[model samples]
Target: MLRAGQAREDIKVVSFDVDGTLVSPGFVDCVWLQGIPKAYAEKEGLSFEQAFEYVKSEYDKIGEHRIEWYNIDYWLRKFDLDIPYERLFKKYEDEIMIYEEVESVLAVLEEEGYELILSSNAANEFIEFQIEPIKRFFSHVFSATSDFGEVKKTNGFFARVCEILDVKPQAVVHTGDHWVFDFLNPRKIGITAYYLDRARKRNVTDEVRKEDDEFVISDLSELLDDPDC
Candidate 1:
């Protein structure tokens, strides 16, 4: 766990991982499978879970870009379902909601003069859908699918963010939910890190968990109490 201390005066920028970090309503993964695919699968006489699994299996073999394309249009054709892409997107939009304390935390950070950037693994459309609600908070928003061609967990992603922000790794603090992808990897590259264990959803091994610089409160409101900020 990270001890309480003042933030470095030289730090000028902060980057965050989206999805489980900021606005986690918990429906993204399950909805893509059960809600979106299942609706189509049922129309085609296939079991919903089976349809979901089959599409996922196909995605795993073809790689991430293929999955991005799948997000655009392939699922309907692949499953022989008649749903339009726009309607499928709406289902996800309606179900999406922000996390408990995101606004308050962001407000505190913005008032501190830190330039905020959103680095996420979701597709461009998904990011667009989310930005509508929180557009005022970030200085820049980037999606791995649209901006980098790979997720933040991969090489070149963090480097790209550093390059774009024109800041060094040590000068920025990264916060996110994924233990390996968000915390460990960014720390390995010299960036400071915080783990947002919102809802305590992830169970990581002690060795890996120890690497985090801080375990921030689950609610964004707690950020107001952060002595460092």
Candidate 2:
């Protein structure tokens, strides 16, 4: 089931990784662990359990390698929250779910012509309200921290997403659920990465990188069961 490039019909562009591989890390963990600490506990009158432990210790003092930690307008202007990231994305945007194998695997990879893309580090204004119910099955939506200021997904952001999808890192193919920005930064350059570990939670790629690289894939319909995918 791991037969990459089965007969090499030249896999043209397939990247995807919007929140836990096409939606459902409970809308970016309910907009950063309960909508920015319930909008800083209604502007510092404090108590959504003490402003989510003081906005999760100021988001662990700026973690996620700080591109303003994936910038929801830089935490609503760093908690000067007069609230308006579109009313905290219309109150958690119903905690966007979207991953029952993501619209039948993006309608079987855009009906098998394969040109979907959404390669994310989530910050095109938080991928536009959870990518608006699959955003017309993507022809491009990249936002390694808002379209390549890259605070994640390096390998020079998969070589500038194969130089703006003029495709050639082996014709591209990516999956997600992050084992180093969706599996070792787009397989470090030659694309064709896949490592979606859906709650099989870390075989840790057989303990750190390429031990005969099975190109793991807990399921996006097993990327259409190979057949020269």
Candidate 3:
């Protein structure tokens, strides 16, 4: 347990994004980039390459950070694809796996009595069907579409989440892989943000350019190792 002063310094609420943070993004990549394209090819009688190009063209128009881009139902309806997106995601459910250190880290945090929240832009059905194995660990699971109808890329999303959790922004710490959505926006609202850069990739958002120092962790285990985060 954290000492009195330590508890005050430590985050009261620790939030994490699902994809590319708690879990590997391989399954989502496979579904959107590969599985859907193959299905499109079969449905449209177009060659795989041609179908992929068509889907990518339409997908680009929405832009990834937008709420519509992350909406599986919207994509299915827009693309006119007869197949359910949830079915496609479940086909690759085995691949939607959590990192090796994820369980251990969450266990430690839970033992330490931090309020853990799983914040993700993923469809609620996707969370229910794909990452269900790890759902037991989180105190609350928040989906952008189902929970708030908003994407985490904006400050409003953070504000809404803080309101739902009934905690001040300064008392929370959010960690995720996206340099913009997860790290920058939360920090803008006074939440402590940690970028989980497992690959050590460079992501210089406007805030990083100005502050010149960004909090980052290559592994979830690093959170346990840090005495002062």
Candidate 4:
């Protein structure tokens, strides 16, 4: 527990994943999932169904864990899409929004003197645009492509963040929506991990129920009340 007026020495860094954690997934879903498919369909003169299938197939080939999966330029080249990637982002920029409870939680964290950082798998350009609404809360932002040259699924990526922050791995408490990248990988490297499954979408097996490291939670407000954090 933090003492009154303490500078958060127990948790030097409270790192957050940008997409689906602090912010809504609308922008990414529009650009990558919906916009890309729609554009592909129009470009190829195919139905939306066919284009979605093709895009899903291509994404499956690369998978979400790799660095290339998050690269817009790579996808543009692979699919021969002629539009500038920034234009796609601009189209959905207004849709980019933070969770209702995010700003309040961030305010509390900051008030308690914890260092707030954004550690995301999103591209730097994407992070830069989405964070304008809540940028003041963050001391620094780290992205997979621009900062790490590796995806968050790689343990090295989180390790590199700890290195860059000049803090011990365990000193950071990372909260995010991904079970692996946000919780598993960071926990493996000794960082405290909190799995933010707001939708409660994860299937809970008997084994999963018994795991000590996976601190599954449904909202950011829970963090403010959790004494252990």
Q: What are the root-mean-square deviations of the candidates from the true structure over C-alphas?
A: 3.8, 14.9, 3.5, 3.7
| Cα misplacement distance, residue 37 of candidate 1 (Å) | 2.1
Give all TM-scores, in the order shown. 0.78, 0.34, 0.84, 0.83
What are the Cα lDDT values of the candidates? Answer: 0.67, 0.78, 0.78, 0.83
Model 2 agreement with the true structure over 134-180: per-residue lDDT tens digits: 78888788888887787888878888878987788788888898888
Q: Candidates 1 and 3: which is better by lDDT?
A: 3
Residue 93, candidate 2: Cα error in Å is: 20
Model 1 segments beyond 4 Å from truth? 1-7, 42-57, 60-70, 74-77, 80-84, 201-205, 208-217, 221-229
Error of 2 at 1 (Å): 7.5
Least accurate stretch of 10 residues (summed lDDT) in model 3? 1-10
Candidates ranked, most accurate by TM-score first: 3, 4, 1, 2
TM-score of 4: 0.83
What value does the lDDT take at residue 45 in candidate 4? Answer: 100
Which residue segments of model 3 deviate by more than 4 Å?
A: 1-10, 203-214, 226-229
For this target, which candidate reaches the highest TM-score against the unseen true structure? 3
Residue pairs that clash (backbone atoms under 3 angstroms), model 3: none
Error of 1 at 86 (Å): 3.2
Report the Cα lDDT for candidate 1.
0.67
Model 3 per-residue lDDT tens digits across residues 1-229: 3222123465688888888888888888888888888888998899999999999998998886677887777877877889887689778877877889988888888888889888788878776766677777677888877788775556788888899889998888888998888888888898887888899776546446545343777887766655665
Scored by lDDT, model 4 comes in at 0.83
Clashes of 1: 0
